[model samples]
Target: MWKHFKFDPNSVNFSCFTDEKFNKFDNLLRFEWEHAVSQDLFMFTIDYNAKQRILDDGDLNYIIGLNRDRQEKRRVPYLFEHVNIPFDNKKFHFNKIKDAEVLFSLDNEQQTDKHLIIINAAPIRPYHVLLVPYRELEQPQVIERNNLISIIFPDVANPMCLDSLCDLLLGQIIETKYVVTADCIVFGCEFVAASAHPYIVAGLNSLCAYASVNHLHLHGMYCPGRMFIQTLKCSVFHTKSNCYLLDSFQPQAFAFEVKHIDEFNKISQDVYKITNYLMLNNIAHNVAIVKGDSFSSADNVLRIFIWFRQSITNGEKFERCNFAFLELSGFMTMPDEKVYNTLTESEMCQHMNRLGLSVEEQERIKDDVKNLLDN
Candidate 1:
């Protein structure tokens, strides 16, 4: 599936510090980083000092620690791992099935509101729930304005809504006495499955997870996927022995495994940052950040997946067609690479500008995103 879309690994400039015949893990990471750099999809200046430290330690603990220090002092955005257990006997209580139905009914009723329904998802992860306006929105528009604002200006209203949803979901879980452990809040404009208004999940939280439902929503728990689980079982790195795992079966269709919960948290933070950057730069419509695994097993042949949204084509009766692809891995294929590569950044910018995102709008979105994460 990916063979048709495979890109030349040599397209990017990357230098690894090992002569010891590239191993499977090394190859996968190198391929991903190189591909990203080549396409100018992401850029970063690595600290030589930190690089030396990591090489000397030959482990992730010291490296991640150094990275954390850099983030605090230099404000460099990077991805890391995080893990959380959703069950708490004292903080949560089970309800009756009738209560669950009632809670669902209430959510259904709330769907009439604009802001509340836009989020389409609820958070069952304690105090967090996803919220959005009820109107149908484009992905870029949501990120540019709605998501950006929610993240940047996480004021009373945002948190209050999240709390309200959480309270409601908990009520439902209790009603069924379903031994619910955790929940996740997924907020999006169109759910792949629901393909309607945004929605939310109230069950188990899995990291690196993907859902077929398209309604805007959010997940409230941190659950790792099969790939992440496999990676952790073989990893030796530890920091406070806390691990954060994410598993995604879409895009590059892979999973992520990291040693610390903080790292995973960092990834979420980075996602916000990336979204903010796009909106601020007047480049929202044609942008995507997808992560997953490309390998069928954990045998050192994995692929680090990343996808960037390219263009929208009007096929048949105005049905929206989005162009996107996985990097480095030849697993999933697409037919639009040449056209994407031919487009200049300015041309891309113009296209986004046409989508109603202006410079001021971008700034607003950036501010909103910052607020969402800070709070």
Candidate 2:
């Protein structure tokens, strides 16, 4: 059994997150979120007050959700124009929780150090929170190969990272319950593990990828939808494992699937090896891990999608539509109402493809990654 936070909805003081059974996490999250909203704890009240539409262009079902309120909040002066901002230069960090409410404070559990689960101040959805590991260590947004490897290997593993991923999946499974409508019909409800109710763990490696804070943290949003990346059209790229290149997707990405925990170590290594290379080369990237076969009644495989794109070195202005891990995964949040209203599928495709490497360059990258892992 995995450890879980002993959560309390009424406490302003820290609640201990320890090794308990993982049955009540979804209930805990929802309870506290409602409590926080009652106390007016968030920077903004983000009730589903935005325009949303879904566009199916043959291969992908694109969710175009516009959050006009969030767009207005981004106009703050401290917003920088560069991806590689120094830690000391930033006016904002997650070291201290402000405006948002804390759900739980994780102590030493399974040899994992301190961590925090705090609500997103500018939340995009209910139960949206940020998970910060080793808060005092003050790690940056960039991924260190050594640190990543330490998390994957059991001897030196920081299970907090892996546990966070599993928590999202497990929470989805546990949230299954029976509901009755006013019409007096009984129905079964099972939320999609990926961003449906509990949360999906997503990371943005640089500002170009819409990372607002330099401090190391992961976003857990309750985005409700079956993302297209969960089951993307793919052609096998490397014969070594379940590695494939997303076919016909803009900004070519490598997708790796992990069917069980035993396969996690090797799969994470392969995924991070490529990410490390991208970090060293000053390439911006986004990572999204979701239930691979989310739509299937019996499948529970997890898929890791990594996209390497052109770094936004100078942040003079934002991209036409900021493409982060979530956007790349198909659940897009358009801050600008105008862009959200007028954007076409073909135009969006062209823009995202241009943001990534050319077809020849991506082919070279594929070859390079295959060689790196094989040897």
Candidate 3:
């Protein structure tokens, strides 16, 4: 199914890194990513609410005001245009780049023309693949199926169209399947306008995570963290299709799911809609994406999850509170061991609560998203 997948860079095309020589190299990527799980970093089914299970380090401060991201602006404005975009070697634009190192982007001709892949310089997990679109200058506004934000993306066709050199990056999708679980996050339009290159980030690892880059990207990490231990599963928002909207059982996060690969692009639609909702209401927000289901498995279900956190107050933004994908989905990767080791599950949970969308706001967002899917 993957060998024939589509890679469309119109908005953001899906393309596999089709190199017979890299076949073995691709396996190496999986091996390194799986090492995190081999170390047992993934969280499986367990009760988080039970006092005995949550945490014991009550003496340590939860670091509710933890502002660890040095790469991002401290006082982030609600729109992408408001922040001061970073400057690169004066010869190049900050995020607007034609070619870059493979780690930063598909920085070469062979890689760009065929299997365009960019590895993260300092990735949250090994083998984090960002499906990049080369045409950053052609920012055409695509169909606005979303009621909220009018997201611009490459036009979508089937996932297996071969006309495009890079139809899909199987490494990203396969990596997700190998782990059985993966986590991801988002940086909506305003979240990182300084870096205009658009891409989707997916990895085969995770627990507590963060969006370290402002360049528009998607995240795919492994497993739900301690924070997503109790995700809300509501069917009221279910579409006629198998797709359903999953709000984090916890208070701070909201997510929607499409159950088939055919609807994978729809995940973008939901994200744009939700981001639009947040923007329209003057609420600053961040979005994230985690692989919905294992593509390699017999489940035959391709689940794609799009989650967003609503920071409705200036205080929340001023606090530099990052309620992006990883945090909302049940984990927050602390800046250092001092914060990570000292923070117990309970404290982390408390911090997650603080970063989430309020109950009423979540409901409103869900309603709007549901309307988009049902239609």
Candidate 4:
């Protein structure tokens, strides 16, 4: 018989419940813990008010949350607010490192076998587990020979880094299965709240498999986590086939291409022009142009990816004053298409010029966008 680990939510100290168990939710074996028990161990909860206090320099040694019924409504437990005791710091070591090797390892076999590693960092999600790569690569943009091997070590460091790591990993995983196919990569980003480390937060971005960069190492998907979530408000429709745009009021979107060294020579100018255009327009975004020669294998097509906010809301205030829940998750507000269409050819050209793109290269991108839209 397989042993199942269980935890009691009401317990004051639930450190003993970190074992693996059969989970009914994912239909696969996973580590399970009681919400109350985890609260006791981590010395915090996903409560926005609590996070705000911490961010304002309040003591973070303890926190409280509403019962399930009051969670969404943000109702206070008038009777139980003072009745339920907060977690005690004496029972746990907040600063101590759990097994560092397990938390940060390059070997896939070693990482897959170990139970999740809980770090001293603030928990972004309930039971947030961070896995760090054993070996640290120099410079975030450099591609390693073994793309898969590279991600294994770094995915755990933090969310900001995880976004790029995810892009690379996704591409490699897809290429290993389908050698030749034109796949589209889609990416998105949102924020996560942190109470313990109030100043720090998290974001997530992901892409589909067909996207590729020419370099053997560049063929994988790449994504990174950010500290904030920016969105635009417009009626944006969703489809699995063509790419969709989320219209926003803020200039928070950005996109870039990834190409193999050989393919880079073919589309480098186009990629440069696009990046220059976005940056010169004062768009708050990131563009990663990965080289194929940096790795053993490379994908042919250059991956053009972009992200911008469609809207921005007072998530922090709502979570704290109203919901008491963490403002980690964001809602997508689509923007007006007419606003995006207002950009004139000359206006775009001027933006490109700011990025130092020559007139000839700007014309090429303009021709390319026009052709893309015409088709």
Candidate 5:
């Protein structure tokens, strides 16, 4: 017999993820079918305040019936390992992570002792994996990301270096052929996104980062709905002659892309350099990595978008702040159907205005790093 889960939502450490016993494809197919017949996913709807939810078809009027009593609105939760967020305002006992099976583990071909990927049991999407640093996972501390790197690599002893970590993340990009709703994963703030089978990955630097649970993690899912992989349909953002990547710039939204090894190396190096800069200033940022497909190569092009934001130390957090990586990528997810139904255009503008970087602000950060992000 299958075991029953004992949940303690108030404990702050209880898990919100699960590895479904049913086949993932079948489950998804079933969800799609239900939308075909009834026009809703279990009556849950999401309001992407800033953007319209991508309509599966023009006829998809999947809102629940008017007579149906409104189901208690609930936002899907991130499968994080932690006690309550900044709610308690004091150290809380660690919530012992459950020993559940993950849909996938690390790629056996290139598996390493340094880090391992655990397909989230209660995942936001299929093959949704979390890269857990071993030493840190085993010993759980509010330590810097580099501390885990130094222990794993042994060569980079500096506490601030993020290269090893970056390399590991890059390797993750190489391993998987798919990423999902990065598009669908949005919580209250519509921060999550998952589309069709396209490579989408993002990372949160520390617990102080916005994700619900405060463990260092990289989020990757396949999303095909992303309209703009490269900023404004332009592949390369060059400063003057298209010889070198512009330090920081995007025509519509601030974004950049990398096509070859030399460009990727320079991009990754620029990442660590900027990360160190943010750390010095005690700021936080979100990262999104995009690829055409698993078979994509340097010639096919890969993109990694970084944008600055406030960290927990700076007293910045979205109580219900949504829109993490995928949302930042232009696709957004709203987990509550009722809210999605109710969210008006004006409210959407309000949310968009209050949160995220303004074009002017994006330009400022881009220009600020114009030299730094270029390496």
Candidate 6:
């Protein structure tokens, strides 16, 4: 029943996961993943077969690529258009997982503090894995903000912890060979069971997202190229909070920043309140927590970008392209060569716009967010 969960002596020591330790663990993870792939444990070798290019779309320039091989190999049970799926216990979940897929387990002082680092059998990018916090808990796909942050990023309320988490993620961007993105996605499960019908999927592939497995996990993927969202400029949305709106970017999004540790509580509350409203309203959305563009060892600023978009339902005759967190964040992985080769900035913008709400609808959501925070 425990699968292959075993404490890794070299794994992160939660009591003190310094920047140096993070570097060591990253190397260890890559080594373990490569070893597993060599042994033919995974479904296929993780390769970047896509032809990539950077488009100069004025301020919203982005990295676009096509991975036709992954498109053929990866499992996509339902398209992004299928949003009203139920949480069926009969389906696969992290609670029941293959032993060989596990990288290792994180067991610190107590056995109950263990977490599983499992390889994504089918990955969108290299070095992809699910960071399952307390695998034994059998938590559902729902995102409980406080519980999630506490377990994955314990003591984040503390400035030191916040900086450490930022360094852990940013270190990947700087030291790793490939671009990386850390997305804690909530696809089909809403904060409340009553409002779950309008849930969203995070990744383009169903296995990577789309409630393929109803398990609480954070996706850590080393993408093929850098994403534009890391450096995209934004205008001030609300004069009161640290939130800023990504103006002029298709599928408008709101971003929150934490330049100083003292701003943690307020920013956390703001993110929670906004996401809570979106979930309750069944508004499909994506949350990306990454190191800020201005990040440095000296000034490690953290950023959180939230995008509330329209759910492409089954019956709707909408634009067919899937726009999840990665696509919205400006690093789209196309399903085929034609789409990748021909998707221009203007057309990409149109597709993104089609997947999102109108300006008026977004304004109303912003007002609702403001009201929630004010109360």
| Highest lDDT scorer | 2
Overall lDDT per candidate, in order of appearance: 0.24, 0.58, 0.35, 0.24, 0.37, 0.54
Please provide, for model 3 over 1-375, each residue's C-alpha lDDT reduced to its tens digit, 9 standing for 90 to 100.
012122222323121111222222334334544553354333321122212122345532222222234223222222233111232233221144323322222211333332223433333433444433332422111112312233234444656556552544432233221211111112121111111122222421111123233333444333222222122343424535344555433443344443343444445555455544544554444444432232333332222344444333322232223455545444443334355445565656565566456778777866776676666
Candidate number achieving the greatest TM-score relative to the actual structure: 2
User: Runs in model 2 with CA error above 4 Å?
Assistant: 1-23, 56-59, 74-86, 98-100, 105-113, 145-201, 294-299, 316-320
Measured with C-alpha atoms, the lDDT of residue 150 in candidate 2 is 17
**Number of residue pairs clashing in candidate 6, backbone atoms closer than 3 angstroms, sequence gap of 3 or more or interchain:** 0
Question: Per-residue lDDT of 228-268 in model 2, one digit per residue for the tens?
Answer: 77666577777776677775666878877655444544566
Candidate 4: residue 321 Cα off by (Å):
12
Q: Write the per-residue lDDT of candidate 1 for residues 158-195, one digit (tens) a residue.
A: 43577786665555442222221101112221111111
Sorted on TM-score, highest at the top, how do the candidates line up?
2, 6, 3, 5, 4, 1
User: How well is each residue in 231-256 modelled by candidate 5, as lDDT tens digits?
Assistant: 32333444532222222222122244
Which candidate model has the greater lDDT, 1 or 3?
A: 3
- Cα displacement (angstroms), candidate 4, residue 64, comes to 16
On the 0 to 100 scale, the lDDT of residue 284 in model 3 is 42
Candidate 5 residue 182 Cα shift, in angstroms, is 21
Per-residue lDDT tens digits for candidate 4, residues 130-182, read 32222122111111122222222224455557777777667555323212211
TM-score of 4: 0.27
Write the residue-wise lDDT of candidate 6 on 72-152 in tens digits. Answer: 676553333333234456666676766666776443234433556678777766666666755565655444454322123
Residue 209 lDDT in candidate 3: 24
Task: Please give the range of 10 consecutive residues that has the lowest summed lDDT in model 2.
Answer: 182-191
Model 4: residue 47 alpha-carbon error in angstroms = 6.0
Candidate 6 — which residues are off by over 4 angstroms? 1-22, 57-59, 78-86, 105-115, 146-212, 260-266, 294-299, 314-320
* Candidates 2 and 6 compared by lDDT, better number: 2
Winner by lDDT between candidate 4 and candidate 3: 3
